[model samples]
Target: MSKSDNLNLPIYDNRGKPLELAYHVTYTLRLKNGYILALKPGEHIVRMPNLLATDVKRRA
Candidate 1:
């Protein structure tokens, strides 16, 4: 299966509410355009909306 089709991760919102909970693989890489590319990892947690908690994880 393609990468996009194989994405299975848990995506939660600011309220810790599950948005898309599943399993997938993620990777972070620096692009030449000065942009960050994040590839969701398998069984990862991807939160949305208020990304306060998500930003905290990135700092660590």
Candidate 2:
């Protein structure tokens, strides 16, 4: 996607890998129950030291 495109949508990496709009840069993901996630534009990756949010990602 272009830099002007909406950031809420899913995107692909340089490797053509599909990535959900991550708190940080796009990467592989493994989901768990009770974990929530959202992709917002930011320089920092949102880390949930505790899974308080419904969105979360683990290693794939």
Write down the lDDT of every candidate, Cα atoms only: 0.39, 0.37
Minimum summed lDDT over a 10-residue window in model 1 is located at: 28-37
Q: How much lDDT does candidate 1 score?
A: 0.39
* Candidate 2 residue-wise lDDT, 17-60, digit = tens: 34456454544433423332433334233443434232234332
lDDT of 1 at 28: 37
Candidate 1 residue spans exceeding 4 A from truth: 1-5, 20-60
Q: Candidate 1, residues 20-60: lDDT per residue as tens digits? A: 43356344332222223344444333433444344565448
What value does the lDDT take at residue 12 in candidate 1? 46
The TM-score, computed over Cα atoms with residue i paired to residue i, of candidate 2 is 0.22
Off by over 4 Å in 2: 1-10, 24-60
Q: Largest lDDT belongs to which candidate?
A: 1
